[model samples]
Target: MQLSFLNLASNNLSGKVPDCWARWPYIVGVNLGNNHFTRILQTSMSSLPLLEMLNLRNNSFSGNLPSFLKNGSSLVSLDLGENQFSGMIPSWVGQSLSNLKILVLRSNKFSGPIPHQICNMSVLQILDLAHNELTGYVPKCVNHLSAMLVINNSLESYIYFPVSGGQLLVEPLLLKERVYDYSSNLGLITSIDFSNNELSGEIPTELTGLKRLHFLNLSNNHFIGQIPQNIGNMESLETMDFSRNHLTGTQIQSFEASSFVGNYDLYGPPLNNSCSSNSSSNKEEVHHVKGINWFFVSMAFGFIVGFWAVVGPLLYSSSWRYAYFQFIDRMWYKLQYRCYW
Candidate 1:
């Protein structure tokens, strides 16, 4: 008996992917994604020459690249994202899979320099190698990928296949910060994602020549130097992210703590959102302002004392009031006598 397709994805299937897969010589597509499946030993595996699409993403599969995949010349789409797979990616992947259009190794533990041989895949439309520990330079020959340089209006940007269960299967990839399956006439959607890696060195200037490339993400990496001035040549570019990179070197190092050290009013992280300096100084100023407000008090006290000293006797004593009236009368009589004379 021969099987044409096998898709048991997103089913919570556990344990190892059975070695029985090696027996399916006639199989065309295999999708066992989003499951809890464990390691598949190299000894039990064999090459399936007819295999076109193999998706084993989001699994517990570990160890190096599967040896059987070295002969996957018929493979068009291969996704192995969010797995525990470790070690260096083999160079033969570029030498073998010339027919590959999409290759996704996102969120894996892959380390070491990306094999520059991948620049040979002339027909590759999407290449995702993000969230890994990969280092070294992105090959200057990246623009040699001929598919990214051209635009085809009649082609669909995503990969979709008819499963054995008589249903359509769409391969998922990261596009515009989202993780979803896109199935439509996406209009020459070519992407290059090397984000979340330790990759260093300047971005290749030849990357600007890819006129039809749709999405480009090199975020969270150690990429340095200026962005290519000819980037505007990418006429069909819709989404491009260079955030969290070392493009201009350190993102926050130049801002320095000294620039904000005395910013007592500023509040936030690296500053802990607590203005202790402002709070302490503000409390001391409250007391200082309070103690310095004695001028009004002294004015009122002097006014009360002066008013009583001059007019208290007139109000409180009759004898003193009569003497004050007599003195005024004598001054008035003396003034009239002098005027009459």
Candidate 2:
């Protein structure tokens, strides 16, 4: 049977995916998504030498992804999203999927830094791996994929490019030309939505080099420090959201207020207040105020001492000295003599 298309979507298919499908050499596309299939994808699928498209999304598959397609040169589109797959994406995916145009592995449980070797795929058009546990800085090689579209963790929406004949002819020259056009516009990159993960540290300033960046989302993560001021240099940026982070300092004036909603420490615009009041002026003012306080205190202390000395003898007889005692005694004797005469 020359099967061109076979879709077994939303089936209750249980257990591992059977390897018998590889016997059909003429099968161009196969989809076994949305099933209860358990265990990792078998390595035997790579034997299908003529397979062009494959989809095994929304399954219970677990463990490190098998690099079965390391030598499959004919695959153009591959989707393994929404599975239980874990560990780093195999490095060979980039090395072997040179002819691949669309690749998707979003909504999986995969963790680890994005592989730098992904730049080797010069023919990749659309790449999506959003909503995973992936961390670390975005690979610089991501700029090479010019024809990428719908790079999101949520796979609800997609970009569709209609083929003229309702089916692609699969010409090698046309494929080469498409790859060449993609590589030529290497700077026309796709959106990278790494938000809602555990990614930390400052925003990589190197990402500003992507001249054709249209969408950027780094929200709801552990990223700290100020947003890179050089982000304004990305002239083609149409949408950017860095909310729910620890971004501080002033962002470029061009960014809208909504772009920085959840960053509590961030302030807008530069302050005009002079922080340069002369040091000498401040010193003199402080000295003058101190001197006035000291003078009033000294005068008050002196007045208290003088008043106490003058009034003490009158208040207490024992406080009277010899001179004051003799004068009082002579006055008393004269008064007695005048009364007797």
Candidate 3:
């Protein structure tokens, strides 16, 4: 019994769980999801020295999460989503679950900011906490989980960054890295996805530091401000999505129209150049051209007027004087002939 694998998923099991299930020393996997067990998880279950995977989703367990799991050294994957758990996430989670690989706690009532200590888990691969009441800026250390897969249980619209030689996936950071496969474990790390949360503020420019990053998604959040110009410099990036936010500025030519949509403030190619800065640039160019035309016209008019004024007197005195004498002589001869006296 202590060395067996227990899988009781989708069962109608009700009432308090037996304590005997917790004392098992060699349990490798346990699935109690979609059950009606109303009692809090036994503390002794956390004491199980060899438990690797546990699924207790879709339950009515309330109050703060148990602290014993934080001390469970051998736990690899844990799924406690769809519960009524509340309070700030414990900071010791990353520090305590050093060997943990996959953790899911989505669709819960948990609130408050994510702990920065989450970056401490160097071996973590997948983390999902979507559809929760959590708020505040995404923890920056999340970028440190080099082998991490998905974040927040959103695999459909999220970007999957994988280690070198890893296969790309359509799920949110849902791609798999083959650390166990000697041929595929090339130690390359790429990908991050954080969409549809209450996260606000500017996108960190430092994220461009991930040179190996090929895909990124930060949509449906409250992020505002100009898209960092450096984002275009990521040569390895093949797909990027930053739609449905308050981002503003001219769209970078490096990214296509699909990269940014639903942002009312964003404008340029594929749409009208309605952005204020882009319009202002066009207006300045028009004004510059008008000023140059006015300058050249004024210079030409001044040259013509100045040249005539300087040479007019000489022309009238030399050329016009001879003509005037001839006209006078002709008029005197005509007068003599007509008078005849």
Which candidate wins on TM-score? 1
Model 2: runs farther than 4 Å from truth? 40-43, 144-189, 233-236, 252-258, 269-341
Higher-ranked by lDDT: 1 or 2? 1
TM-score for every candidate vs. truth? 0.69, 0.60, 0.60
Model 3, TM vs. native = 0.60
Candidate 3: lDDT over CA atoms?
A: 0.66
lDDT of 1 by residue, 1-341 (tens): 78888888899899876777667788888888989999776643356878888889999999887888887898888888889888998898889988788888988999999998898998898899999999998989888888898776653444455455433354656864687554453224688999889998988999998998988878777666866767888887876766656443112222233323333344344444355755677688888887677767888899999999979989999999999999999999999999999
Q: For candidate 2, what is the lDDT?
A: 0.66
Native-structure RMSD, model 2: 18.0
RMSD score of candidate 1 (Å): 18.5
How does residue 329 of candidate 1 score in lDDT?
100
For 259-281, candidate 3 gives per-residue lDDT tens digits of 67878778888655677865586
Error of 2 at 331 (Å): 76
Pairs of colliding residues, candidate 2: 125-148
Q: In terms of TM-score, which candidate is stronger, 1 or 3? A: 1
Better of 1 and 2 by TM-score: 1
lDDT of 1: 0.76
